[model samples]
Target: MRKVLKADSLFFYFFISLLWMEVIFRVSVMKQSYSFGILISCIFVLSLAFLFFFLCSFFKRKAGFFLSIFLLGLSSFIYASQFIYFKFFRTYYSLYSVSNGGQIVEFWRDIAAFAGKHSILLFLFFAPVLFLIVFGKKMLVFKSCSTVNKLSLACCALFAHGTGIAAVYAGGKAPNSAYDLYFKNSYPQLSVERLGLLTTMRLDLQRLITGWSPDIELAAPRDSKYIPTPAPSDKAKEDPNERETSGKIVEYNTMDIDFTQLAANEKNHQLKEMHQYFEQVQPTAKNEYTGKYKGYNLILITAEGFSPYAIHKGVTPTLYKLVNSGFQFTNFYNPIWGVSTSDGEYVACTGLIPKNGVWSFKQSGKNYLPFVMGNQLQKLDYKTMAFHDHSYTYYGRNISHPNMGYIYKALGNGLDVKKTWPESDLEMMEKTIPEFIHNLPFHTYYMTVSGHMQYSFTGNYIAHKNKNLVQDLPYSEQAKAYIATQVELDRALKYLLDQLEEAGVADKTLIALSPDHYPYGLDMKTINELAGHTVEKNFELFKSTFILYTKGMKPTTVTKPISSLDIIPTISNLLGLEYDSRLLMGQDAFSNASPLVIFLNKSFITDKGKYNAVTNTFITNNGKTAADEYIKRMSAIVEGKFHYSAKILETDYYRKIFSGNQ
Candidate 1:
C-alpha cells in the first residue's frame, strides 16, 4: 500500500481533493439534485484525472510536477468559472466561448458580483493548485518508474479510460449518441456531476478542435403532408380521391404546400425526406381567434432580462395594460438556452430551438427562414424592419435580420440611439418610431437592451437613470436594481404607446412583447424575494410574461403551456399569414395543437407533466401519469425536433423545401 501510494500519491491526492471539492460545490452550493448517477460520474472523473496524470508522467519528475500543477490551475479556473457563470447567468459556456474570450471580459462585473457572494467556495477550488505548486516537487514523494514502465502505465491508463466509458455506456443509461452523451443527457451541471470538470473540458476541447459534431439523423414525420386518408376498415375507405373529410376540416392557412407535387419533383433524397416528414405534422387548426389581427401592423419586442416580476402596474403601467388587456398567456415561459439572449431571441423570432454551441441565428443567415414573423409579413409588402439598441453585429444579427426579410439597424448602423454602457430602451423606441411608424401596414422587430445585466445602480447606467423609482421598494438591492433597469423598459413601452396613439395606429397595430429570458442577473435568493416564495428552479424560474395587445382588442386569456419558441407561428396564425406549421418546432398557443415547452437541457413541460431530462424522471401534474409508452413516444418526438432544428441550421433544409422563399 505504501509503495502504491508513493507511485502517484501527489497526483492522486490532488485529484481526490479537486473531485470532492467539485462534488461538494455542485451538491451543496449549486444545489444540484444528489444522485448515485453523479457518483458514477465522479468515478469517471477520477479515471480521467488518472489518465491525465499518467500522460504527463513521461516528462522529467520536476518538469512533470510543474506541468501537472499548471493543469490543476487551469482545471480549477474552468470549474470555478462554470460555477460562477452559473451563479451570475444561470447558463454554462462551451469551449467555443473560449474562442470568444473578449465576450467573457465584458462580464467582469458579473464575475466580481459572484465572487463577492461565494468567495470561500471559489478559494477552495484553487487550493489544490496552490498546494501542489508549493509542496508537490519538494515534499511529496513519488515512486520511481523507468521510461519503459511509464509508457506501459500510460497505455494502461488509456485501457482503463476506455473501460470506464464502456461501463458508463452499459450501466449508466446515458443517451446513445456522442452528441447526446455530452449535451442532451449531461448538461454542464450534470456533466460535471457525472464526468468531472476535467473530462467535460476534454470532450469540449476535442469537439471544438476536431471539427467533429454529432451526426444527428432527423426522423421523418410518419404521415405525409397530404390530407390523412381514412382507414380502409372505417367504412371501406371511399376512393382515395376524396381528400377532404366532413368530420374535421384541417386548415393549412395559406402555406401553399403541395406535398405530393414537391415529393414527386424533388430530386434530392434529403429534401424529399423533409417534405415527407412535414406533411405528417399536424397543422394548427384555424380557430375563431385565427386572423383576429389580420392586416394589423406588428411591433414585436424581445426585452432583455424582463420577467413577470417586473410587470407591476404601479411602476410599469404600459406593460401592465398590455399584459392585462391583450392576449394574456397565463403560463408562458422563456427558457434560458445555452447561448443566452441570442438563442432566446432566435427561438421567438424563428420558432425553432437554437442549435447548441453554434449561434443558430448566424447559421440561418444563409437559410430560408420564411417562418420568421418579418418574412411572413414581408410577402404582403409590409415594410419589415428590425432594430437592436446594442451592436447590430452582436450574434451576427446583421446577416440574420436581413435573411428574415428585415432592413435591420443597430447602434452603429443607420438607427442612432444615445449610447450608454447598456443603452436605453426608451431612447430606442423614441429614435426607431419615426423609421417605421408612418409606414402603414408595417411589421417592426425590436431587441431591447435597457433591461440588460449587472443589475445595479452604480455600474449600470440605465438602472441608475431610474434608481429613484425602485429605491422605496421592499426588496434586496439586487432585486431593486433589476426593477430599476426594467423601469427604463416600462418608460419605453409608455413612449411606444403614446407614439402609436399619436400615429393613429394604436388599435390597428398589434404589440407583442416577451422577455428574452428570466432575470438571470438577479440571484435566486433575490428572485425568491421578488416572488415572496421559493421558485422551483427547474420550471418556475422560466415563468415569464408574453404580452400581446392591440390597443383595446377583447381581452382573451390563454392558459396553456407555451414558450418563446412558440412566438413565430402564433403571430403568423393571429395575423392570418402564410406559414407551414409542420416546418416549425413550436405550435401556436391559441391553436388546438398541444403545447410543449423545451428547455436547453432537453427537459420539457407539457400540459400534463414535466420531465427533467437530467434525472430521467417525470412528474405528472395529476397523480394519473402518462403511460410509459406515451412518454417514450413524446420523448422521441422532442428528440426529433431538436435533431431536425440543428439539421435545419446546418444543412439549410428550409431553402431546399421552399425554393422560392429566399
Candidate 2:
C-alpha cells in the first residue's frame, strides 16, 4: 500500500476524477457526436485538473486530504445539478440564468421526482467523490510539497494550460467548430460539447466580466451553380378582399424610412453597417392578405409547452377548431432556444432571435422595440395588455412586458388567479377578461402556465385538475398528463371565444397564439408514443401548430415553412402596421419573400429544403439538388441573423436607428 500510494499519485487521482465527471456529463447528458471536440475537451480538462492538483498540494497532509475531498464533492454536485437542470428544461442554464433562478424553487416537487428517477446517473456522477472519501488517504499522499516541488507543479500547470490553448486554435475557425465556439459564438450546448463544461463556464464568466460580444461582419451572397426545379407555389390562397381589387395595384407593407439615408447619416460604424445591410435586403411585397385585419383587435398568446400533439378534437376541441379553421401553417416550427420559454416569447413577440447567455427580453426592456405588436398597436390608440399566470417578475417580465407598451399583470401584480403549482390558464382568462374585454380594439398578450411540465398526474396541479378527462385516453401516463394540462388551455380558449362573441367582437378580434416551445418537458419516448410515429429529432421535433383565427374566416393553408420568429412580422403585415420589413429578421408568412425557418442551433428550413447545421447536410424539398452556393449563402444569412441579433441586445440598435423618429 505504501509503495503504490506515493505523493506523486495525487496528480493521477485529480486527473482521473475530473476526467470521470466530464465524460459522464457528456455521455449521459449531452450525448454529443464523437469529434475532434472531445480531444480538445480532454486537453482543457487535463489542464484544469493539473491546476487543482497543484493547489491541493500546497496544504498540510490532513488539510490537503480534506480539501481534495471537498473539491471533488463540489465538482460532483455541480455536474449532477447541471444534469438535473438539463433533464427538466432540455436546455442548460447559464450563469446568468442561475443567478436569476430564484423561481426554480417553484418546481421543487418536480425536481425531486426527476432526481429520484435519474438517481442512478446521479450516483455515477458522484462516484469519484465517494471513491475519494473512502480511499483517498490510503491511496494518495496529501502532505505539503517542498518549495522546489511546488514550483515544478506550478510550471506543469502553466504548460498544460498553454498546450490546451494551442490545441483549441489548431482546431480552425469554421462555424460551430471548437475554435469558433471558444472565441466567437455563445452557443451554450455546442460549447459544452466541444470545450467541456468547465472551460465553457470559465469562458462564460470571462465574457460576462469583460463584456465580450461576438464580432459581426456583413456577408456577401454566394453565387450558386446548381439551378432549382421550381415547384408549385405554397402561398396561401388569395384573400377575398383582393379578388374584389379587379386589377388594382397591391401595396407593400413598408415604411418610409430610407436605409440609404440612415446609413449615410449614421455616426456609429455598427449602426451604419446595419443600415447598409438593411438597404440591400429586399422587402416583402404586400399580398392580398396584407392588412386584411386592419383596425381589428389583436390577442396574442404564447402558450406554455403547446404543440401539435396538444390538439385533439375530442380532448381539446377548441384548440382543434382554432388550428384547423384559419391560416393553417403546415410547416410552422417553434424552435427551442437557450432560455426556453422567455427566448421563445422574445422571438415570437419581437421578430428577433434571442441572444444566448442573457435574457434578451429583459435586456430589451431598456431598448426600443418599435415592431412588437404591443408597441405597434399601442401607438395606433389600441389598448394593449399582457398577462402571465406565474410570478410577475419571473424572467423580469414585469420590466420587459410593460416596456412593450402593455399593461402587464401577473400573480404579484393586478391579476388575481389562484396560486397553484402550475397556475390555471382558464382561471387566468376568467379573472382578467373583464378588465380588457370591454376595451374595444385591444391588443392583449398572454404567457400561460397551465401547460408547464413535470408531466405526471401526481406532480402537476393542472394535470390533476383535468385528470378525469384524460383517464380514458390510450397513452402513457406522462402523455396523458401532458394532454390534461392542454385541456385546460382548450377550455381557456373556448371561454375567450365565448366572451368575444358575447361582446359582439368575435369576428373583429383576431387571435394569434403559438407555443413558447415544443413540449420539451415530456421525454422523447413519451412524445413518440403520443405522436404515433418516430418524430425526427433535428428539424421535425420543433414542428408545431400556429393558431391564427377569428370567428369566421376562409380556411387558408400555407405549405411554406415558417417559425415563431415570423409571428411578429406576419401579424404586423396583417394588421396593416407601418413597419420596415427589412429591419426584422422574420419575413411575413404571407409574403412573396422566400420562406426561411431558423432554429436555435443555426439549422434552417427554406422553401427549397432543410439544412441540418449539426450534420452539415441539406435535404431538398423536391428531390432536386441544391447548389453548394445556396447552402453557403443561407448559412451566412443565418449566422448574420444570430450575430446582429446579439449586437442589437448589446448595443440597443433598434433605439439607435429610430432615435429621431421616436
TM-score for every candidate vs. truth?
Answer: 0.90, 0.93
Task: Kindly list the per-residue Cα lDDT of model 2 for residues 1-662, writing each as its tens digit.
Answer: 75545767888888888888888888898655557777877888778777877888789988998898888888888789888888888877787877776456778887887789888999998998898888888878888878898898889888888888888898777677777788888887888888888888888888877877776568562223321211112121122112223456545455666676788898988888877765555566677777899999999999999999998899899999999898899989999998999999999899999888888899899998899988999889999999999999999998899999999999989888888979999999999999898987898999999999988888789999999999999999999999999999999999999999999999999999999999998999999998899999998899999999987899999998889989998998888888877678888998877788898888889878999887778999899888888898788888888877787788888787778888
Off by over 4 Å in 2: 1-5, 146-148, 221-251, 265-267
Query: All candidates' lDDT scores?
Result: 0.76, 0.84
Best by lDDT: 2
Model 1 weakest lDDT span, ten residues long:
232-241
Quality of model 1 by C-alpha lDDT: 0.76
How many pairs collide in each candidate, listed in order?
Answer: 4, 0
Which residue ranges in model 1 land beyond 4 Å of their true spot? 1-7, 27-29, 141-147, 170-186, 209-249, 258-273, 614-622
**Model 1 residue pairs with clashes:** 41-194, 221-277, 224-279, 225-279
How far does residue 565 in candidate 1 sit from its true spot (Å)? 1.5
